[model samples]
Structure formats: structure tokens, C-alpha cells
Target: MRIKYKMVLLILLPMLVVIGAIAAIVFVQEKQLAAQQTLVLEESLLESKRAEIMDYVSLARTSIDLLYSSGRNDEATKEQVKAILRTMNFGQDGYFFVYDTQGLCLVHPRQTELEGRQMWDKRDPTGFPVIQKLIEAAQQGGGFQRYLWIKPTSGKETDKLAYAVLLDRWGWMMGTGIYLDDVAAAKAKISQESDKRIHGVMRSLAVTAVLAILIVVACAVAVNLSEQRSADAKLTAMARRVVTSQEDERTRIARELHDGISQQLVSTKYQIELAQFQLPESDENRAAQQALEKGLDGLGDTIAEIRRISHDLRSSLLDNLGLPAALGQLANDVAAHTGLEVRVDVSRCQHKLPDTPAITLFRIAQEALTNIVKHAAARQVDLLLSSDRRSVALTITDDGRGFAPEAETYAQSGGIGLRNMRERAELEGGSLHIVSQPGHTVLLATLPLSEAG
Candidate 1:
């Protein structure tokens, strides 16, 4: 996979996982909390319903008390009390009933057929004696009871909440009830609404999570692309510099040959022709002796120029005497040319290195020496080469008036030399580091040794 894709996964996978986990946890917890709240709300509402039942029963008892206190204690008054309770109605299935302690129905507003009938053993669908339980509750000073009973409006057996109280003076059990399914319906409605709101919240969080992952992926891609562009630009510039450096080297070599060796060879050739024209006819060997001698001197100068050019291109001594000898020669030449105190120390690198690495290190040292000759004002220079079983290192130290390290720009101060040295070190799988301060500058190159090289 491409690095950008890998980075996107690396940046987003963990974030998405955490978000998903948190969302799941929140959703589950919210649903659980909603269920709990529904139960609490149902209880609160059921309690209020139970209170309404008590009030209805209390009003019926008060009406009976008023009739008794009015001194109307007769069959007529009893019938009147029954008429008042039968007419007391609020909603569907809302009414009062009166039964005797023996479970005989006396006044049933909605079910008049069961009036004056013995219902002491009447049981609901769940096998509870509904009439017996209601009679007991009334005789025990009014309380609530839950059971299945016939709903007057629907004419079907449904769960009911009833409250009852005793009429001690009349041996009557009077009570009223409300259907339980109404409360259950309210609870169901509340639960449905809660689920809708919770689901909405979960969806919003999911969208937020997805958007967050997209943002992270976008940022990662942007960073990777930026880095890739920067790398490409650097490679392009380095390639251009390599081509320019090669041409510059070729031009320098051409100039040296044309100005130094080529001119001297032509001069030597003319001198030889002149000597031939002035040859001693009698074999005295003195007529053209000066011309011949001057030709020989010219030939010597030409040979020296050729040798210098060859050394500039590549030193034969480097292949023969190895890197240590080559570096020592370089130090000597630099000292001769620049009048600088130069030291070559290679006591620790006696082992011969591979050919390519040896050449790279030599070139780096050459470039450093050239830079010091051209730029550094102070004289003393030290070149050290060392090696161990795993790696080899070279250190070039010069006590010179140094340039401002921070303010130094490769373009402004001639970057080619430094760039070439660094590139050479990298080609050999080595690294180069430079530290410079006032009157002191150090350049170090370290190359690891592999089994093959």
C-alpha cells in the first residue's frame, strides 16, 4: 500500500474504534436509563390515579354520612343513597359499588343485574376472589387492591386499581376503581418518545464520528503529499547540481590541458624542428646543442604538466599506496600551495577499505582542503582517519576564521563543494557532519562497513 493510505489508516482506525465504542456504550446506557425513567414515571402516575380513587370513595362515604346525619335512616334513605352512588360517574368505567360483608352485591351502578346477588366467591381470570378481596379491604378501613375486574364501559375483564372503605353503621362496603390499562398506555407512549429521542442522539453522534475520521484522514493525506513534494524538489535540485559539477570538472581539465600541457608540447615540437634545421653538418654536435637542450627542458616541463593533470583527474598513488598514502600526498600538496600547517594522521586506519568508499573519503578530504585554502584565513589543519571492525571514520579539523554557521547559505557561499562532498559520502552509505565556530571548524565523515564492501 502507499504510505499515504497507510498513514490514513494509522491515524483513523484507532480514533474510529474509540468513537464507535463510546457511541455503543452511550446508546446502551441511554436506553437503559430511559426504561428506568419510564418505570418511575408510571409509578408516579399510578399513585395519582390511586389517590383519585380514594377521593371518589371518600365522597361516596360522605354522602352516605350526610343522609344518616339528616335523620333519614329507613328503606327510603337506603334507596336514596344507592341512587346517589349509581349517578356518580366521571369517565368510562368510572363508578361506585356497595357490597355487604357477606360478599352480597347491594349497589352496582354499571352492573345492575348483579345487585342483591350473592357474589362472595367471584374470582377474576387469575383466580383471585375479586369480590372477596374488595369486601375485605373495605372492612379493613379502606385501602387499595389490584385485580382483574369487568370494566363497565368495555364489558371486558381488565386490570383495575380500586379503593374501598367500610360503612360500619350500615354493614356496607363501598368502593370505586379505575382501569390499569390506561396507565400502561401512558407508560408505553413515554417509552416510545424516549426511544425516538435517544435514537436521534445516537445518529448525530455517528455522523460526528464519521466527520472526525474524515478530517483526520484529510490532514494525514495533506501532510504526506507535502512531504513527498518537498522530497521531489530536493532530488531535482541535487540532480541539477550533479550535472553542473560534472561539466565544471570537464571544463577545468580542458583548460589545464590547453593552457599548460598543449602549449608546452607545441613549443617543444618547434624547438626540435629548429634543431634539425641547424644540425651540425660535420657531426661536430655543437651547432644546435643549445636548441636541443632547450627542447629537452620544454619536454620536461610538458611531462610535469601532464602528471599534474593526471593527478587532478585521479591519483595513481591512490590505487597503489591506498587511501592513507593518497591523503598524505594531498596534505603535502595543500601545505605547499597554501603555506598552511597540515597534519595527516591515519595510524588507526591501517586496514585497506573497499575501492569506492576509499575514493569517496579521499574526495571529501580533497574538497575540505580546497575549501580551507579558498575560504579559511587561519593556517593549521588536521586530517584524521580511523577504523574499527564495523565502520571507518575521517575527521578534518582546521583552526580558521569561520563563517557564521547559522547565516550561511549554500547558494550564497558556493554550495557545490559542500554538496558534492555530502553526496559522495551518502553514495558510500556514509554520513557527513560539520561543526564550525570562530577559529575552529570540524568536518567528520563516518562510513559503515558491510561484508561485501
Candidate 2:
């Protein structure tokens, strides 16, 4: 894959994983919350339904109690009580039932065919004796029971919820039931609505996750592009400076050759010709000899100027006598020219470095000493070089008036000398560090050493 896309992935993968994990956790929590809420809602509704059914049963019991109070021992009054129960109905299929303690049906308003019949052994679809269990519930005073029975309105076996109580004085069981299919229907409806809400929440979370990921991706790409642009701009500026530096060097060399060396060479040539002309003249030998001496002096000055330029570019001692000797010569030259007290130390360095490492270290030290001479305005400078099998280190310290090392100002300082030294060190897989304060400044360069040949 292309690096840009790879970078984008690197930026987004971690965030995506975190968001995904969080979303999953939220979904699970939401699911659990919904289940809890649904269960509570169902229980609340069932409690309300239970209260309504209990009220209906209580009304029936109150009326039957009144009838028994009017004629406790009258058979006619008891028959009238049965008639009142059979007729006291609330809705379709909602009515009362009566049975003896022996499980014989006395009044089944909805299913009159079961009246006066022994239902002792009769069972529902689940094999529980329905009328027998109802008798037991009534005998225990009053409570609720669940069973399957033929619903009159639907003519199908349906779940029933009944409340029953024993009429002890009459030796009878009286009860009423509400079919539970309606309750089941209500609960199922609530469940369906709850599922819809849960689904809605899930969809909303999905959309949020997608949007969050998109935002992260956009931010990552924007940051990466901005960094890349800034880096490109820095490289471009450095390139332009390199070109300008090269041209300036060429100009300086060309001017030296033209004004100094070339002029001297021309003067020598003219004197030699004049000497040849004078040698033929009989009493002009002294003037010819003087011209020849002046020409030789000019040639000597030209040679010295050429050597100075050559040393500025690269020292011959660096190649012939190795890094230590070259550095010692640099120290001598700096002390001679700038009159700065220069201290040199190289006692620790025991191995000759490879060409690149040696040159890189030497160039850094050269730049540092040059900077000190030009700007330090101090009387003392220290040059220290040390090395072991693994690395070489050079340090140059000067008691100089220092300035703030602001990054922008340093980069725009218009001199490539410091930059060149730093680049050289970096190219050789080394580092250059500079620290400065009032009356104390240090430059240190560290380079890795290659194995000796």
C-alpha cells in the first residue's frame, strides 16, 4: 500500500478499535437495561390486572354474603343465591362458578352442561385436575390459581386466572375467572414496542460510531498533510541556501585567483621578460637581478595565498597525519592568528578513525573554532577530542558573550558554516550539540567509529 494510506491506517486503527469496544459495551448495557425495564413494566401491569380481577371477585362475594344473611337455613334462599350468581355477569365469558366440596359442579354459568356433574377427576391439557385443584384452593379460604379451560367466547382451551373462596356455612365453593390470553396479548405488545426502541437506539449508536470514525480519519489526514508540507518547505529552503552557498564559494575562489594569483603570475612573467631583455644590455644587470628578485617574492606570496585557501577547504595534515595531528595544527593556527589562549587535549583517543568520521569531526571543530575567533571576543578557548572503540567525541568551549539560540533566528542567520558542520555530522550518523550562556559556550560533536582496517 501507498505510504499515505498506511499512515492514515496507523492514525485511525487504534481509535477505531477503542470506539468499537466502547460501542459494544454500550450495546450490552443497553440490552440489559431494556430487559430490566421491560420486566418491571410487565410486573407493574400484571399487578394492576390482579387488582381489577380481585375487585370483581370481592363484589361477587359481598352480594352472596348478603343473600346468605337474609335466609341462612332456607333452601329456596340458597337456590335464589345460585340464580343471582349465574345472572351476575360483567362481560362476555365473565361469570361465576359454584361447586360442592366433593368437586361436583353446582353452577357453571358459561358452561351449563357441566352443572350438576361430578368433575372430581376432570383435568386440563397439562393433566392437572382443574376442578379438584379449585376445590382445594377454595377450602384453603381464598386465593388465585392458573389453569387451561374451554373459554366460552372463543370455544378454545385458553389460560385462565381465577380467584376463589369457600362458603363454609353453605358447604360450597364460589369463584370467578378472567381469561389470561388478553394479559398475554398486552405483554406481547409491550415487548414488541420495547424491541423497536432498542433497535432505534442501536441504529443511532451505529450512526454515531460512523461519524466519530470519520472525524478521526479527517483529523489524522489533515495533520499528516500539514506536517508533510512544513517538512517540504524546510527542505526547499535548505536547498536554496545550499545553491547560494556554492555560488558564493565559487565567487570567492574566482576573485582570489583573478586579483591575487593571476596578478602575481602576470607580474612574474613581465619581470622574466624584462630580465631577458636587460641581460642583453651591457650595464643593466643589477636592474634585471632586482626585477627577478621582486618576481620571485611575488611568486612566493601567491603560493602562500593558494595554500591558505587550500587549508580553508581541507587540511593536508588531516589526510597525512590523521585527525589528532590535524586538530593540533588547527589549534596552533587559531592561536597564532586570533591570539586566543587555546588548550588542546587528545589523550583519550587511541585509534585512528575512518576517513568520513575523521573528516566530519574535524570540520565541526573547525567551524566551532572559527565561530569563536570571529564572535567570542574572549581570551581563552578549549578544544578537546576523545574516542574509544565505539565512538569519537569532540568538544570546543569558549568564554564568549553568548546570545539566545532561538530556532527561527538561528535558521535564518544567513551563514551556512554552522549548518554545514551539523549536516556533515548527521551524514556520518553522528550528532552535534551546542549550548551557550553568558561567558560560557560549548560545542560538542559525537561520531561513531568504524572498525580499524
All-Cα superposition RMSD per candidate: 49.4, 48.2
Q: What is the C-alpha local distance difference test score of candidate 2? A: 0.73
Per-residue alpha-carbon lDDT of candidate 2 for residues 88-206, written as tens digits (9 for 90 to 100): 89878889999988988999888899998999898999998888888888889787788999989889999888888898888888888888787677667766775786677678767
The list of candidate 1 runs beyond 4 A from truth reads 1-7, 69-76, 218-453
What TM-score does candidate 2 reach? 0.44
CA lDDT, every model vs. true structure: 0.76, 0.73
lDDT, residue 2, candidate 2: 88
Highest-scoring model, lDDT: 1
Worst 10 residues of 1 by lDDT: 282-291
